[model samples]
Target: MSRRNHTDKNASGDPRKRTGAPGVSAENGDGGYNAGIAVFSYIVGGIIVWSLIGWGLDYLWGTRWIVLVGALLGAAGGFYLSHMHGLTSSRNPAGGSGAASGPSEDGNSNAK
Candidate 1:
């Protein structure tokens, strides 16, 4: 008598296969942030940074509204650039979203 070997099969009768890992999509397997989120974050971050710089400059130069205007323009430009670059993932190192590198001279990231 001959014995038959049975293999696991899906409902469709195709051999069942296991995916390599979870949280990973077949597309863009880098495991980074979704393209939308990254672009939004970059745009927002750039705007905030540019605005802050403009505000500081205005304060130092005693110019009213000048810094605000410049900040607005800078923010707009930064947002456009970020969008163009498709700055998607702000997490995975492959996406270049890692934390700040090195230490500040004042021993604080927020040091002026």
Candidate 2:
């Protein structure tokens, strides 16, 4: 008369379990949120880091306008990096599909 703890480790000591509901999409998954956060962090981090560098340069050179340029350059670089990453991921065929890729006769995919 004891209840089974399905959430805990199974008999074989394997932690993987497929007990959850299926048919979940990436838009509703954590992947999209994580990607967004990564992009945002890149942009923010670039701006902050470059602005600090520019401030240091200005302090050393006794200039007052290089900080703005540095900030703008940092933002542009961040945007470019994010855009490239987005493009690369979008171009990947396995990106949109949440399935394991298999080998094809035509040898188009690297999957085995």
How far is each candidate from the true structure, as Cα RMSD in Å? 18.9, 11.7
What shift in Å separates residue 63 of candidate 2 from its native position after superposition? 0.6
Candidate 2 colliding pairs: none
After TM-score superposition, what is the CA distance of residue 89 in candidate 2 from its true location, in Å? Answer: 7.9
Candidate 1 local lDDT, 1-112, one digit each (tens): 9753343432355545422123334245343455455555655677677778888888898887866676677668766765445343243737544667777566776866
Structural similarity to truth (TM-score) of each candidate: 0.41, 0.51
TM-score of 1: 0.41
Among all candidates shown, the one with the greatest TM-score: 2
- Where in model 1 is the C-alpha error above 4 Å? 1-26, 29-33, 86-112
lDDT of 2 by residue, 1-112 (tens): 9776655443455546422122222233333556666667767878988999999999999999989888998888777766765521444334555655666567866655
